[model samples]
Target: MANTRSSLKRARQNVKRNTRNKIIRSNTKSTVRNIVDLVKTKAQDALDPQKIYSAYLL
Candidate 1:
């Protein structure tokens, strides 16, 4: 092939990885935050944790 790939390839890989990690991290954070909010506000988020867990599955 031509001299392998360009530096952009590595950069793109990093971008993809960062995006994936960011999304997952955000999800986990929001999950925990939802739990915290429920406890702090003393209100039911979904009547049970099962609802949150099921939502995370998607």
Candidate 2:
């Protein structure tokens, strides 16, 4: 449906960017879920500060 060459190129770029974004979003959600599970299954005293810090950085 793109009438111009530039528009066709832009459409392709959008598709590529969309797929890349979806992968990044999924990975971020998985990392957060893992961090939450780690905190939930462990006692406060047993939680590792380093792990918490790293998760926060992510």
Candidate 3:
């Protein structure tokens, strides 16, 4: 559907960025969910400030 070469290139870039963003969003959601679950369960590691800070850093 892209009529010009530049548009086709942009379309390809959009697809690549969408895929990458989806992966990052999924990972962030998963990490947040895990942290919430750990807090609810009162897990010892979750109580550590360093570990919790490091989780988001990763």
> Model 1: per-residue lDDT, tens digit, 1-58?
6445786788889999999999999999999999998796655656568877998899
Candidate 1's error at 21, in angstroms?
Answer: 0.9
| Residue lDDT tens for model 2, 1-58 | 6469999889999999999999999999999999998888786645879878888899
Better of 1 and 2 by lDDT: 2
Residue range 1-58, candidate 3, lDDT tens digits: 5479999889999999999999999999999999998788777777889999999899
List where candidate 3 sits over 4 angstroms from the true fold. 43-58
Distance (Å) between predicted and true CA of 38, model 2?
A: 0.6
After superposition, candidate 2 runs with Cα above 4 Å error: 44-58
Residue pairs whose backbone atoms clash in candidate 1? none
Q: What is model 3's C-alpha RMSD?
A: 11.0
Query: lDDT per model, in order?
Result: 0.84, 0.89, 0.91
**Number of the predicted model whose lDDT against the real structure is largest:** 3
Distance from true position, residue 36, model 3, in Å?
0.3
Query: Candidate 3, after superposition: displacement of residue 18 in Å?
Result: 0.7
Alpha-carbon error at 29 in model 2, in Å? 0.3
Ranking by lDDT: 3, 2, 1
